[model samples]
Target: MKNVAVVVQDGAEPFGLGSICEVWAEPYHPDDDNPVFEFVVCTAEPGRIEGGSGFDLFVEHGLEALETADLVCIVPKLDFRHNDPRAVAAVRQAADRGAIVSAHCTGAWVLGDAGLLDGRECTTHWRHADELAATFPKARVNPDVLYMFDGNILTGAGAAGGIDASLHLMRRTFGARAAATTARRMVVPPHRDGGQAQFVRTPMGQTEADTLAPLLAWVSERLDEPMPVERLAAEAHMSPRTFARRFRDETGTTPLQWLTGQRLALAEELLENSSLSVEQIASRVGFGNAATLRHHFAASRGTTPQAYRKTFTCLEEQSA
Candidate 1:
């Protein structure tokens, strides 16, 4: 997408707007070829807009800016209950014109108000998922995901979820290379597995010391080694069954699930930062072989290892 218009209204959340700007508004990259988006902040009521932090921002553009945007992003607002009809109409118009219409946090409410959420699969910040679903009965809300993209309409959960959704859109539009460049510049992971479920659950235990933090660290360090539940249980000094129970209690996920996630993360790091072949990365991350890595990587990341590497290889390394 060439042009991006961020819809900001009164009570806009700074972090949400900043997240959009970080991904789309940043100028050209120094190391890689990346698309530069013409990012503009537009409001239904132009001029001074109040932010959620009680700060006032002078927005120069009106809703008219959204008409020419290739992507229309709605920044989170303080109250999802109150939405301006003018802002809602602009969102609807943008969506009707086939521009990607995305929302961060409670911004989904604006899409709902625009009647764009009807019969579409979407998500909002978990705290507001129920209300979003109840208010828009036709919209299918999956609360557990970090983000959901249905057609050209995308929605993210709260806070950092906006970053995740924005990166995803970048990857979708400009290829993984550009997205990885932006992510590296932002110093954020290019992709994150799992969902808001990990955040919504109460801490596995009240005190950090009450959980198996040590065991987790140990396992992370030895991800290249074989780690069956039996080995992990032994490391934790508990029976296999007991270890499994405590693992779920401590991490909100099973031992295998956690290990696979760690391996995948390491694999992604290797793919982006190293020149290792797929088979070599697979061996380093305990996936054993290129075929196995391809299976798991595609299953978890929706892209093959070779393709991912090709899209995310460091530009410096490429020239060298």
Candidate 2:
């Protein structure tokens, strides 16, 4: 069993806290045995810790709970850049003692404030993401995933991504079957690959909400089909000249630009999720051949498709 510590502060949201507790609060009996973790919840002081919800969260333990932890998990705060120094100090001490440090959601910002996130891969709630990347260029800021595990320091994306982060920890700790079993019991997906892109944005175009959504969706769904300016104008029910003007007005770019983004999105998904050859991906994503796909993938992502897959693929390799 692992000595796991969950560190919380004022105004902590229930979702993030509850998600961690849901997984760690109990034990799973393999042979109808006891719980697997010796879980501890610690706040700055004993008694009640006020959370985002109306109710006050009471954790009997204090910072001392981290002293003997084999793994110390930081519950994300609402505003990490301005958190108290003592909270930051506890984080440092836990990491200093060789404890596996984990941060969930905007909790990663606390690790960032503690200076432990430097030179490591991390993610945070997308709202504060620009500041995190701007503040710490040395750290690899992956704003796209549910979580990241760079060695012992694991950082999760947004609040909901806590499930993915915790499940990832289980996968590494007890193996795939145990993780899958826990997920099934909890009624969550076994794994979510790619990034928070699938979670964050509502796809390439919800142009219908504004003036451009339908036009964008129509073009995206037919990537293999030709998207001529005149043809698109007809879809929008406007003359070619008027359509071009409205397209720019609504999306702030020409129709072709939006089309490029959608195609690139598909290309990346195929590369990360499938064993499809570059040529096949290119065809599916509207690019004519491997050369075009390679050019765009390298230019936009700074790496080839093959290399990206090797670095990010999380599932077991398919057997022949």
Leading candidate by TM-score: 2
Per-residue lDDT of model 1, residues 1-320, tens digit only: 78899999888999999999998888875576668888899998789999899688999999999999999999998876899999998889889999999997999999999999999999988888999999999999988789999998999989999999999999998899888988998999999766665445322213232558887777777888999999989988899999999888877788898888888888888887887888899999898988988887777665677776666677887788
Per-model clash counts, in order, read 0, 6
How displaced is residue 302 in candidate 1, in Å? 16
* lDDT (0 to 1) per candidate: 0.86, 0.77
Error of 1 at 162 (Å): 0.7
In angstroms, how far off is 207's CA in candidate 1? Answer: 21
Which candidate wins on lDDT?
A: 1
Error of 2 at 194 (Å): 2.7
Q: After superposition, how far is residue 21 of candidate 1 from its true place, in Å?
A: 0.3
TM-score of each: 0.64, 0.67
